[model samples]
Target: YAMTAAHKTLPLGTYVRVHNLENNRSLVVRINDRGPFVRGRIIDLSYTGAKDIGIVGPGTARVEVVALGRRDTSAAGSATTYIQDDYYSGNFTFQVGAFLDRENAERQKRELAKKYKNAHITVYDRGDKIFYRVRVGRFTTLEEAVQQEEILIQDGFPDAILVAE
Candidate 1:
């Protein structure tokens, strides 16, 4: 995996440099998903990332993790204590709008994606069928999402609301 994988401790959107300690290879990845959930894995890398570090075939390797800088608005504490206290916070994102018609949802998503790097649509079962939700950006803290919600409101997506992802 080239993009960074999940770490139980690192907050989402954290910029980190993962080093393949045994081979001395390194690559930077943005933490976007939660995982490795398996014990002993510190960070997961996307296929491209693992390939870059020469670990694709092996599927896993020892890596030295170094935070480039946490994009996480909340960095609780040292690596150890941080993981413990970290449960206090949750990952959040702003939903600018949702539409029953996939076309409308896709239109909004395309429009927003053109203007915002993190803009995308999430489809979920709202009732008997599915609904498309146009969401933009991820934040480690609810406050950040709220702030973005206000901006989206000002930008005319008045329905924007903060939601946990």
Candidate 2:
């Protein structure tokens, strides 16, 4: 699937939400190319796209995709202009763990905080399920986030992945 964005460039694996008209179901798909370009279409789905909307045999279906904004990649050290009321919010920060057990997550957060001063945990509730996330650092660029992920992996958190804010 492809996502429509104001900017011409889009990175691969960019997630887009696709909604099926028939079933009112939605699925997230990755964008890898230019676009659908049809008159009124928002996204172009592949032959296996039917499976996403829960109809494998049907060739085509009306669908809508809400394109989540792309990642900001402005270079570091660029002059940033802030309005009077605007504070420097800094960059995006995320943790490594999103566990179901809060105690386990807290334990991990404490252990990580000893090494990484910025380490913290957040709890999320989705339906009846609970999730605990452990994250560190406010990174201004994706490169910094990736570097931190590498350091975390080398420190034994091999399963760590970079997430956007």
CA lDDT, every prediction? 0.72, 0.60
* Model 2 backbone overlap count: 4
Residue-level error in angstroms, candidate 1, position 145: 1.7
TM-score for all predictions?
0.44, 0.48
- Candidate 1 stretches with Cα past 4 Å from truth are 1-88
For each of the candidates, give the backbone clash count.
8, 4
Off by over 4 Å in 2: 1-90
TM-score between candidate 2 and the true structure: 0.48
For model 1, the local distance difference test gives 0.72
